[model samples]
Target: MKTQSRWIGFIAIGMLVLMTVAPAFGAGRPETTATEQVTLRYSWWGGESRHNAFLDVLDMFMEEHPHIRVEAEYGGFSGYRDRLSAQMAANNQPDVFMSGHLPPWDILPWDARKDLSQFDLDLSYYDDTLMATFYAPDGFLIGVPQAGGVGGSYLINATLLDELGLELPSMFWTWDDFAELAQSVYDASGGTVYGALDEAGGVPYANAGPPHFDISYHNTTITNENGLALTADQLRFTYEWWGRLRESGAVSPADITAQADDGANSPIVNRDVAMLPIAMGSFSRFQDNTPDTLVLFPAPAGPNEPFTFGPGMSYQISAHTAHPQEAALLIAFLTNRRETGIRMGTEVGVPASGMYRDLLIEQGLSEAEEAMFELQNWIIANRDVRGDITVHARYNEFRDLVRAEQQAMAFGRQTIDQTVDAVVRHARNLGMNVR
Candidate 1:
């Protein structure tokens, strides 16, 4: 009888122990219900319209899932990278953050974002080539393209072009053709209104060239798998191309072009320039600035093929998030939901999902928005998803150095050969594998 009683006592103790340990380990516990509170932090950089649109989407998300609360962190693009880096260093990065799809940005590193393949997010409606751009070095998708990753376009002031009596160029127009049209606009406007912005002067020169983003000096790509693949002669061609525009008054001089920083001061918004080379997603801002009808068309092609592309943005989740499931759900709502895309419009970019894009199209879009969507579609159908060039952290610095030299060449302060030499030397000094 005593042995039986002792065995029963032992079993009771074991059960008590398990009950005590179960709460601590959270093992075999019932899952939290939808009524449980889940708060997530999301950050992005954009203007007021983007901010409002995001808030509206977040509001809708909260309404549908009442238990999840989202904290908003947003601001202008300036210092955004620095802020994100600081937050990450402190291990307090936002659960969801805006990440650039292009290389050498804050979130491009494999380690910077979580491998989202483990999540249950739906990406079936996205284009394969467009989807591939967001993959990490290990082929794990780290983010979903925002809008459709806005590509470069010729943001034409149709009103200005009409007033000038110049027809808009075809989507597949060549660089030589673009130059002729620009010259015609210049001559017809009697030099008061310029043909286009000197995209080489202040704007990034990569976008200034024809749409082929991968073109190198003597090769098909500017940067190869090993390193910088451009030659001095190829670099010279870029400078001389822009210099000719300055010579013909097709574009403004460096000093004059430097003042066009967008908003009310932008040459496009002010109607001082007939066309501007810019990303397709930014059309709304230019349109909002003026009542003039604006249209977006594919960038002029290079000598070989189309190179301009939608280097899209994405909503990347942090690996350190305490609410991974909630964060993933939020990302799905923002990136995959057709309603969210419709609400955001081109504020983010064209919708990344094919279904979302189709839905947005059916809902009807402004002329500018329609043009952006068409351009994105064309890019997906036509442009090659070139492999990324591993640029150093000082990539932008090198670009600035080259820009200064290009401006010097444009102003006749430096020769084209001198400009090329300076750029190559500067790039090499930055530890870039320039050819």
Candidate 2:
């Protein structure tokens, strides 16, 4: 009887130990409910409209997943890149951030972002062609496009055009047609309003000019296996065309064009110009800033009808995040959720996912939003005429260089030929294999 009592005592001690140890072990494991909380930092650059829309989305996300909390870091486009760079260098970047399709962001090293494919994202809702652009050369999916919309268009002030007695250019107009219409607008307006802003040294003009136009007119790539594919003469053609416009007062002067920093101060919004080269994603934002009726037109075609399309922005997860799964979940929620689409509309550009886009359409769209949506569908249907150029890793630097030279030419500090020579020389110095 004493032996039986000792065994029972031992069993009680073991049970007590097991109960204590099991709770300790389970303490480190996250609960499947709100009791286990995860916090994430999300960064992006945009105006107040984008920030407000994103805030609404975040509130909705937190409501659905009560356990996850997202902290938003956002601001205007100015200084955003510098801020992100500083964060990255400190190994303290946000868990998820907005990135553009160009420059330093596009060339971020493979390890800079967590491979998004590892996350439980429903990527089938995304367009395959668009998704391909976000993959690293080594085949890791580095980011997911936030908006798969055409990045370039001619945003014309239809009200201004009507007042000036000028009909809109055809959907299939050419560069020559563009030049003539611009001149006509100048003449009709009695030299008061320029036809378009002088985009001579701007990124938009560069995309529409050397890359798309060169392919159409010269049947040459802007960048090739050899790099900097345009010959000196081919590049000269583009510069000279703009130089002529500047001289004829068909476009804004150097000072006026330089003053156009954003939609608020854009020459078009100010009624200083009738048309502007713009990203289709930001069309609604621009429309909101002005009272005039805005319209979208395709970039003037080259003989070959080549154009470029890319994501307006993409959501990237930091490789250094402690909670990558949660970060990815936020991105997935933004991309695939129906309410997100309805709330976001085209504020972040059109939804990249077809599912969300269809939802937005079914819910109805504002006139400006509908125009952007239809234009994206038009570009996709004509994807065969897409540009065959590659945006280089150093594209941002190259673009700035081109812009500076163009500015010098516009201000009459350099002649067209001199401008061309300087660009070619500097491009080679920048390690572009200018042939």
TM-scores for all candidates? Answer: 0.84, 0.84
Clashes of each: 9, 0
Residue 420, model 2, lDDT: 80
Backbone clash total, candidate 1:
9
Query: What is candidate 1's lDDT per residue for 1-435, written digit by digit as tens?
Result: 999999999999999999988746632334345568977889999998889999999999999888999999999977887898888886778889997746434434566777889899888998777777677667777788776754546778888888889898887776777788888889989988888887666454243222242352233433333445567777667667867898888987676675676665678888677877776666777788898888887666775655543365788898777777888889999877767878887777677778877777787877766777777777667666443534455655666676676667766788778877887888788777876
What do the candidate models score in CA lDDT, each in turn?
0.72, 0.76
lDDT of 2 by residue, 267-299 (tens): 889888888787777787788899999999877
Top lDDT hit: 2
Clashing pairs in 2: none
Q: Give the TM-score of candidate 2.
A: 0.84
lDDT of candidate 2 vs native?
0.76
